[model samples]
Target: MFNSFLKLTSICFALLLLPISIMAQELPSSSLYVVTSCYVNEGSSFLDAVEEARATIPNDDNAANMMFFRQPIAGTNFEKNQFFRVVSWNNLQHWAQPRSLPATQEYSCDNHNRTFHTTRVVGTNGNTAYTDTDVAFVSARQCMAKDGVSLSEVYDWVDTRISRGQASRQNDNTMVQMSHKILGASPNVASGRMITIRRIGDSRQGYARFFDEQFMGTRDRTLGALPDAPFEFCTDANLTESYIVHSPGRGI
Candidate 1:
């Protein structure tokens, strides 16, 4: 795997001023997040992972939140502890299996790797109905502070286009192309596979392949995108399909 961390926590970085419009969708006083958990050697049980999380999170932040993955964050009923979610690796069970268990499942001493990743945003109801694109920005000048003439200059050019309302121009697939170009150059920040977009109580997520020096095959790191919840690695469902229908839209 590409040096992927199992579980990561957010550091308290001061907020850079964002547009008030976008800021409005940000989670309340609490910092919003996109958490990803994965089990590499042998997938871990949902309950066990949840037990692991219980030891990691503070008590207050565990109240009234949402999680999504192979299914909704509920065990038949949405009741107490709507605040947390636990998803197993049953996500791609139908697609990944032929008709029987994989021969590998017989192997014991399997190591399960779980990851939690998130970004803070304002005001979404933590539902699937909301959608938006998230971008990480840096100044053409600042990005070159040491490396010199970084590709970030391209964003300023794109922003100029958007300011002129050309963000919709088909000939220019601004974001997608930029992702490829940047990864081609930096090759490191590109290690992250899940790109998440958050708004208020909800968010949209998608997984992409990232390069790793250690894997023989392309590691399929996509644990599907989720609303303010955990990413699901195996599932036949893509819930945001219903939510982001009317577009001419984009999000990270």
Candidate 2:
């Protein structure tokens, strides 16, 4: 009788831990992102800034991907001529490799840098493939998990909604990314919070269609409905015009 009880207890414990082990294996590997916010110098146009960035920035084997996001001045906290530069690595090990930047005086901008651990929640863009002409309309916002809610729980909730086909109006070209601040963020944003970025389309027309679908067509009330979502996202979303600067397989 004693031996049977011991076996039963051990089996129950193993069963309880089984789901956790499976979830761990299913979790996607995260990438590291180095994001820089900058303001172009007075009298310098965006074209000049882009040219300077293309010439100076590292697009070597270590860097996984790079992008430039043009921030709109109206209805945004950003100053005039403000933009963002984002560089990503496959993992922390790759990012730790010694990479040097060549000296260049052509790039003129006041910049602040931050690092993040970014994970993909939906879509297939893993930040790997891109073309020079590919343009994306991006919407980013800060979010905080609710009390007793874990990050994995939030990911599971999003995954469930996505599986149900209620996540977004965009097609397969869309990508939803969640980024946790590893180096920098405002004091208002707590450490438990994360930044969510949604890339709507490959072009401006795709973004327009998204809005039209939201207002004109049937609304997706189930995407982030309360009682279903484990976290809450901020209402103030920053929209930007994103352009691919460098990608691995694509020629610069």
Candidate 3:
């Protein structure tokens, strides 16, 4: 009887590990994006400074592995000096390394202390359109959900919205390409949060198109939808935007 109990305990342990392994497999290594907030010192072209330092920055394998940039357009909540630097990588192993970029005298930065949730490729115009785009309009929304709503459920709802939006648009080039992922660690401001990024041809128009297609439409259909209301489940939704800083010949 004791031997049988030991075998049962082993099986439970293996079962517990199975989901973790499966989740790791689901996370795309090639789809990593790291965003850091920056505040430039008074009277300086922050983008140009970072651009100049790019060449001289020393070997920080993790930082060097990905592209860097500043996000310019944002909501009123974010200050004018605020910007975001984004990076992409292949595989979780590379992401695990300590990423370092120089904090020059030109600017100060605030980094997110979290790992990325699974990345979903909403749709692509061509295989290379995502990388080829000049700028990306990233919408970062931080919020928490009502009681009993699981994180996986939230992801499922988001995935559905992305799929429907992608399908609605016949021309991928005309509209923005959208994708979203949750933050693995809880953000300081909220119980849960998500970053939604769209690689688009124009920031202003693309931003408008996203709202008309995704947010407004989702709001209208929530009650009638099969999976039920996703947006209504959350409170304190704060959205802010950023413009991508292009790093040529370096992204995946």
All candidates: TM-score: 0.21, 0.77, 0.57
lDDT of prediction 2:
0.61
At residue 156, give the lDDT of candidate 2: 69
Which number leads on TM-score?
A: 2
- Model 1 TM-score on a 0 to 1 scale: 0.21
- Cα lDDT of model 3 by residue, 6-112, tens digit: 99999999999997776543332236656566777787776665654565455444543445554555455667776655566554667677755555776666655
- lDDT (CA) per prediction: 0.25, 0.61, 0.51
Worst 10 residues of 2 by lDDT: 123-132
- Per-residue CA lDDT of candidate 1, range 1-252, in tens? 333332221212223334433434422222232222233123544344334433332222222233332213312333221222222121233223333321322112221323333232112122223324321111010011112222233333323433332233222211211111111122233334323222111122221110111123543433433332222221231211111111222310
Top lDDT prediction, candidate number: 2
lDDT of 2 by residue, 1-252 (tens): 999999999999999999888666445667777777666677776666667766666776676555564555224667667777776677678767888766534344434445555656554444322223556676766667666666666676665654454244454344566666666666666665665644445566665565567557766454453676666655556677766656555554
Candidate 1: what lDDT? 0.25
